[model samples]
Target: MNIQETQINFTILNRFMVLKKKERLAHAYLFSGPMDVGKGETALGVAKLVNCENLSEENYFCDVCPSCLKINSRNHPDVHVIDNEDGGTIKIDQIRGLLGQVKMRPFQALKKVFIIRNIESMTIESSNALLKTLEEPGGNSLLLLTVSSLEKILPTVRSRCHTMPFSALSLRVMARRLMSDDGEFPQEAHFLAHFAEGCLGRARCLKEDKIFIQKDAIIDQFILSSKSEDFVKKILTDKPKTKGLLDILLSWMRDSLLVKVGVEDARLIHIDRLDDLKFFVERYSFFVLNDVYEESVKTYKLLADNLNVKIPLLIIKEKLRYE
Candidate 1:
């Protein structure tokens, strides 16, 4: 696909064009952003642009050339993509394999490109192994690393490469993209867009998730029911367990704060829960909403740290009741 047609819009494209014009592209680059913001697509586009035999004045690939066709089919010998293997981490052995390949000359294109997705998922040993390659990469080879969580990446790895930050797309742009594939999405597209918080991947995932629908219903119940007993019971008995309910509640509370503070552009994962959000915002003071938001964030962090999910939920329940 052409660079312009990608889901994301930013100065990166223009910068890339300028760099290509000057023939001064970086040997290694780190594309950091939230998931589904077109980082991978952009990386592929860069590869195609760099290697395209038939290039246009706009610097876009002809897409009709042999090189472009090979890249599109993911059979280009010069372009290497390294992803997680068999649901496991990218190990030191895998990095060693890639490093071996990098030593070889490009098979077709003038430059060879190695694209690594989810670099944060690389094991510590693997990251250290890759550091040598990054420090003294081959002259004709380029490394592109895509990561969602920069914190998980080794500081040494992060410092060696040029960094590009990708932000989430606007709801309107996301909705438009979704509409192109599924026309029926427009009405609910805004809602999905809000919930996706600028990440197209999350929006698409939410669209396919029945849990989001159930969460919407639960939020409706929370708004309609005077007593929290039924809502709590339904949450506790849900198929995915209380974690789903807790997640939705946290998202709702976040939206409540956004709405209360008059933030015009908030990425709420539960856009359909606006009524519930409104109710919460109306009933609770800004301070209370902020506290709820903080608690929700803490709960998410605790879960990430392997803390027992029940403890956080119980604490959240008690806080809600106390408030």
Candidate 2:
């Protein structure tokens, strides 16, 4: 979908549109929000709007224009997406390469735009290098940095750019968007929307994820693993092979924790499995369950940093089994 048809209401989108009309857009902006909430997409939308030869009267991009088409396809020479493509860190070399490109004038569009995804992944050297770019970004150049939170970015970097905060998308908005596509079930839409934690991008990805194939087995193993070592081992083997496993595990722990704390059923992510989740929660003390949840989060961060996943997986298993 194009920028004009966004389901979630983004304050930044309206703010930028005003800036575009006033011709007072900033050189650098920090887009801070939860993952998959469309910070990156919004940055691209800004690029399209600023460069489109035929912007609509409603301040939307004419997606048919050459600039909009190239940006949409991520082939625009003036629009660049910088992310951690090598190893797990955005290295200094990448920043240097980007700076070299930013030095040049726009090839076709009126403004050159750079959208940096997961800017928090930048190494110390890279972050330092980015400071130079942020401080002296060229007149016609725009830098858009997206991170889960401002705490992840350097103070110096954060101070240099206008910060735009995004919150989780509403459940109704996300579910409605999911159901808009043909052949999607309403029941599945409700579940996917909650499971995505208010992120439309995550909702879409979850709809097609292969890990859901093991849902029943995984849930059963999680419930049984409290007493059976064999079940725990099976869960380890059955864990999602992708990074998405952490999200699934976190969701289960979160649901159990919510039940243990007497959170309302309506707020539970695993509403459909409330009975099973309550059963599981009853088996463990609140402190133990909370510790496991904290450890799981730490393990997820380590895994994202390119550490071996098996060690953390075993650690989590042991925590769940004996803690």
Candidate 3:
């Protein structure tokens, strides 16, 4: 999709354009949001806007300009990317290296842009190494940092940059984009859109990902695990995709809760599976459904916190069969 067509954070993009037109843009900006929610796309769009040779109101980038093409192809000399290339962490050396480059003049464009993806993965030393550069980044340079959450970033670092909070798109927007992006996904469009948590990019990925189909089978299996004589043994012994399984179960439990409470279909994340969710909701009492939902939430949290997955999974299995 084109830059303007992004459903998430359209207001922020317009604000960036206004700032650029008024010559009041900041030196550093932190685009914090969920993954695949257009933070990186927006950052790259800003880079193009600042460097486009033939920018126009009708189109953010002329699309054919040399500068825009370079940025689009990720070949722009002035547009640098600092990511977790080594073992999933941005080290001190990388920060120092970026700072050294920041000290130089732009090679091709009017502005030198450094797009730092996964800034949350920066080590403490790396964060400190970049503090001075952030504080006094001289010349026509723009620092764009994309992170999933602000809480993981150092408070000092966060204080130095213009933090732009991004949110996921609505179900309708995601579903629409899914169909537009891939016509083949129309049959499963609503399901993937809801499952992606309103991220168009993620919806696209989920559409092509075989693991998603496996996860669906696992969820279905778990929902019927109660009938199996060795449900606990099967679940506890089987090597499950921990994060994916828990996330699907959480969505299922959440949708069931919503159905039980008479929530609007628009508000439900599993909009495509309303009948299935209703079936599950009817099989449990209000308290049992609420209890399972809480357990699902707690188990997901525990898994995210790096706790052992077996205990939590066992707990969820028991809770699921509590009846």
lDDT of 3 by residue, 1-323 (tens): 36546543667777888998999988999999998898888888888888989988976667678999998899999998888886499999988888888868899999999999999999999999888889879578999999999999899999999999888888777777777766745436777777887888887776667645755566567764665334434544444455667777877787787789997466676665677777777778888888878887887787677676666666666666745
Superior by TM-score: candidate 2 or candidate 3: 3
CA-RMSD of model 1? 4.0
> Which has the higher lDDT value, candidate number 1 or candidate number 2?
2
Scored by Cα lDDT, where does model 2 land?
Answer: 0.79
- The weakest ten consecutive residues by lDDT in model 2 span 233-242
Model number with the top TM-score: 3
After aligning candidate 3 to the native by TM-score, how far in Å is the CA of 112 from where it should be? 1.1
Query: Can you tell me which runs of candidate 2 are displaced by over 4 Å?
Result: 1-10, 224-228, 237-265, 274-323
Poorly placed runs, candidate 3 (over 4 Å) = 4-9, 184-187, 227-240, 261-266, 305-323
In the range 1-323, model 1's lDDT, one tens digit per residue, is: 54455653346656776788898998899999888898888787778878889887855678889998898899999998888867579888889988897768898898899999899889989898889999878989989899997897999999999999989887787778777755635557776676677677777777678655766666665433455565666555553555666566777777777889875353555555565566667777788777767887887777667565555655665555534
Worst 10 residues of 1 by lDDT: 1-10
Tens-place lDDT per residue, model 2, 1-323, is 55535533357777887898898998999988999888888888888888999987765677898999999899999999999886399999989998998768999989999988899999999999999999778988999999998999899999999999888878977777778752456656766888777888887777676435555555665534654455445544643442555676788888888899898556776676777787777767999899889988998887678676666666776776643
Cα RMSD of all models vs. native, in order, equals 4.0, 4.6, 3.1
